[model samples]
Target: MSEARNTFGKTSITQKSKKLQPRVDLTAMVSVSFLLIVFFMLSSFLSRSNAMDFGMPDKRHIDCGTEPYCLGEDRLYTVLVGINKIVCYEGNRLDFSNETRSFKFNDNLLIKEMISKNQFLKNFYGDKKGLIVIIKPSKESNYGNLVDVLDEMAIVKVPTYAVVDITPEEEKLLADK
Candidate 1:
């Protein structure tokens, strides 16, 4: 004879059958993934469209570099654009006492002077490419002032430019002057 078995809960051991329910709420997951995709697309677009702005000189490639590795060579005339004053330096030295002294950016005369001087430099050097303006702002200068100087440089159509900070050596030289 067959034997009867007892189960934890139910009418009888073999009376009820077990059933499994399939579960999958994919709607929330799909919504989240879609939102993530949209967010990333927008973020990437914004980042790609942002302007590439640089501040200060890139010391690694240009500043403190050696020989031909340094920025602004003999082929380019170097113009120093400072917030309070714009001075021109050549051969990495500013000699005010020399007969060929530096020019200051003041009123409209400075721009005119720059044009004539740049013309002379281009004629002599045979590189009419454009001037190389090195922008240096004094520590006490405001950002707006620096921007104004940059605007003037832009108006003059500088080919390319770099920024230089007043190093301890440069400051001492200026102080001695």
Candidate 2:
């Protein structure tokens, strides 16, 4: 609201002088400011990114003799993620005869197995980095199981690991369990 007042007592023609104070309406500006704040807050919260970092094998052929990072059969640790159980084995071959060990997703046995294998490698190779984990999630396994396995790898501080496609033989092994 603006008020008008007579600044001068009288004008030359006996007319009173008037002065009006300026008024500014800031209701729209304040509303827009609040709306913008809310919009930015929501956008920032929704746009936040969540991710996990892991190495992927190179597409090109890698020679074990030449490449220092090349994984050998003795250092290979394969994990098969199933619907209710996780099967793990050390070495390149997936031998169910005696090597394949199964553990439930909720149990810490898988973590123990990984740690033991990592320790075994560290002891045998006398190297700081040795274990190379390869995760194969079956179709029956959910995304959560895969995430859990990756988390276990992180927990164990495994030097190298990768998520790979499951082969038909491995899938059959999982189904037989």
Candidate 3:
């Protein structure tokens, strides 16, 4: 917006001068702004978001003692997710009695335990593949527990892992606890 003012300062009768008004053109500014918007819109990429790497095992390779050297109880680490509690076991079995331990979620006892176990196994066996985690979410568990266990697995850097269903014996043991 602009205003024009005309001034008459001691003008002579024979000589008179016309006052000129300044004009500002908004067309160039508007066009430049529009062009910039168009450029940004065209330069932007519209693509799908990346998914988290869950590291799912291949079904074709899974063998429950159908082949030799299959994943056994000692090499496998089972993480049972429950309401505000976590139960972890290491072995080739899911009997829920051998080497089973429980921890509350508040102190991240599960992750700390997992880290210690991984470190111990790494130092003892000298093999990263020695620690395979089998995440078993019981009926008492929720999605948050599952997610937390997975996050802990990532933090602990477990080499092999999977999410499996709970067995009846395991459910009975969980109820007893």
Instruction: Please name the candidate that would achieve the greatest TM-score relative to the true structure.
Output: 2
The true-versus-predicted C-alpha distance at residue 1 of model 3, in Å, is 64
- What is the C-alpha local distance difference test score of each model? 0.57, 0.84, 0.74
- lDDT tens per residue, model 2, 39-119: 999999999887778677776655577544456877888899999898877765565454888889879998887888889
Which residues of candidate 3, in runs, are more than 4 Å off? 1-50, 57-69, 127-130
Summarize candidate 1's per-residue lDDT along 20-101 as a digit string, tens digits: 7989989999999999999999999888854324456556644363553364454344444444554444544444542222
Q: What is the clash tally of candidate 2? A: 0
On the 0 to 100 scale, the lDDT of residue 43 in model 3 is: 66
Q: How do these models rank on lDDT, best leading?
A: 2, 3, 1
Give the true-structure RMSD of model 3.
10.1
For each candidate, what TM-score against the reference? Answer: 0.50, 0.66, 0.64
